[model samples]
Target: MNNSKVFGSTLIIAGTTIGAGMLALPLASAGIGFTTSLIIMITLWALMAYTALLMIEVHQHADNSATLHTLAKQFLGKKGKWLASFAMMFLFYALCAAYIAGGGAQFAERIANFTGVEISGTNATLLFTLLVAGIVIIGTATVDKVNRVLFTIKVLMMAVVLTFLAPNVTESYLMSMPIEQGLVIAAIPVIFTSFGFHGSIPAIVNYLDGHTPSLRKAIVIGSAIPLIIYVFWQLVTLGVVNQATLIENQGLSALISTLATTVHQSNLGQTIGIFADLALLTSFLGVSLGLFEFLGDTMKQRGVSSSRLAVGLVTFLPPMGFALFYPQGFITALGYAAIALVVLAIFLPIMMVRKARAQSQLSHYQVAGGNLALAVTSGVGVLIVGAQLLITAGFLPALG
Candidate 1:
């Protein structure tokens, strides 16, 4: 890939992966020992890569230009389309809402700590939403340009924190025993939320030369980048922080602040707070752009030429409302929403491939040697995560 192409690909990967989940990784991994978390990270990474490749299969095999909605419509008809749309709409927008609320809350909290300005989540959300909404309404090219900057900043800020925190990690933290299934059940949604590979498939496919081989390579390479970043970030974070402190903060920013206090007192603590705020804001900005683009593209495909306004509202209103009414629900709601997205992103793509195969449309590389094995592995992973999600949602009891 050309430097520009690689940069664009990496930006998509980074943008997809770095969202509300990045903020909560430590907390999610806390119950599962650091070592187990690392293990899960590897498992999820492979699973994500497999699914991304499968999505490429779907993209290639389709006879017409399509998005996930149309793919579901082709494979499973009206009902499947409805389910996919519901899940995508709920999951993507809810995440954007969570980002706005969480980012706003974090921003307000940090500013209050440093300055005496009594900022509320509602006010913060309003300001942030307006800024993002303006950029989104302008168009896709502008959004991509802005994302390049935000993504670079986010990665850099994370790098700084990792540098300071990695040395402090103890082997004992990484080697602790895994928690019971109850915690794992509760954590699946959180884990899924942090992994955002599914949403990028359509864009990657479009960017590719529209050939099976190139699309496959783009999706595989693209998804792999984030998986590595997630695993690396988890290692650096869990390594440096004390287990109990990690549990206590329940948010990455707070844990980093605590880390700073121990490392260099209140001075360093404030600095970490600012960096965390910037990183999260960048994440929020990227997601807002994506959400706008998704909605606009969906509407355009439906022949709605005036989707730009709808996209603006879709990006802005929900999060602003959540920030106003119930800022705290953002993260927990995001966890559940993530399960739905994973179903769409990971599981549905597999289903698309199977449907293609049944129709005899699946190409050779799609069902290539080892890919079926990867698919089976992905299926097993989904069952584990799905059962855990259902149990956590009270649809099933904890496993005996």
Candidate 2:
């Protein structure tokens, strides 16, 4: 129960949760109104929190530290293992692509603003990838230290943006917009993606040496930090930028560009640009680290060489290729990634917990609400999946 360990683990969870997905929040919820968006945010936060706790419970039941792949195989057999691995890989790859595309755009914009020289998105992606890949290749210990610093800078930048925009945010902006029904459903996936901390649960469990109370506290506190940050962010962005403007602009870059023009402040725009790049960078480190470690471990278990370079290639190349080809699909990538996340984070946890219960193997830390909670959580997961499918099929209109 070392306090520092708890704090470090908490930072890991918070850092992972607050990433590129956040850049899509204001746009996604724009049509839904700020008040309804707030309610939706709180609801998704509680749902994700519960699912994350379930993941920890499953992890603690293991004799030693095991990943989602291992847990799925042990509890749900080969089919489960295959599905879990595919979902995890797809989700991570999609997220990596989204971050790469986002980081490159933000980085390129910052460069152009400062120097008046334009860099192509593909070139920016390659440059940013190579830079962060070096730090990621060094290993998780280095990543943890870097993440701490980056996380602090990210929070401060967010504060600065909010502070500048605070005066412009009126009660009218917060309360005036009408909630659009279909748009709210569309925003749920984005909200889920924003609060996505479950992927880091196993890493945190190992980090804290399986101390349940400390791990639980870290999850709760870490998740709550983003919840607070998001609320204020929505307030500022929705307050300053109108709903129609968000819908028209329709992506992270456009949103920020609009903010700058609307606010008539160059410094504010620069601060937010820097903030976007830092946010994506920190998340890239956490996610790439997770993917690298998972692949390296799986390779070792299969009696293969898990060298740094080998794992780095496997971890980054596909996402890099995708980002290169589809450099403008940041928010779309996150939305699709949410489908895979629901499978891995939400649906998988409920199934795992139920199987563990059936086997009479319980952990010291169990998520309460029992079968009813599982039913509700699973239903919510299914509904999210449905929304994603309908959106993908063009049955429901896509939100920003």
Top-scoring candidate (lDDT)? 2
Tens-digit lDDT track for model 1 on 294-328? 67767888988765776688668876787668666
Query: In candidate 1, which residue pairs clash?
Result: 169-239
Candidate 2: worst-modelled 10 consecutive residues by lDDT: 172-181
lDDT of 1 at 42: 68
- lDDT of each candidate versus the true structure: 0.68, 0.84
Q: Each model's TM-score?
A: 0.84, 0.92
Runs off by more than 4 Å, candidate 1: 1-11, 63-65, 113-115, 265-267, 296-311, 361-363, 368-400
lDDT of 1: 0.68
Tell me each candidate's RMSD, in Å, in order: 3.8, 2.3
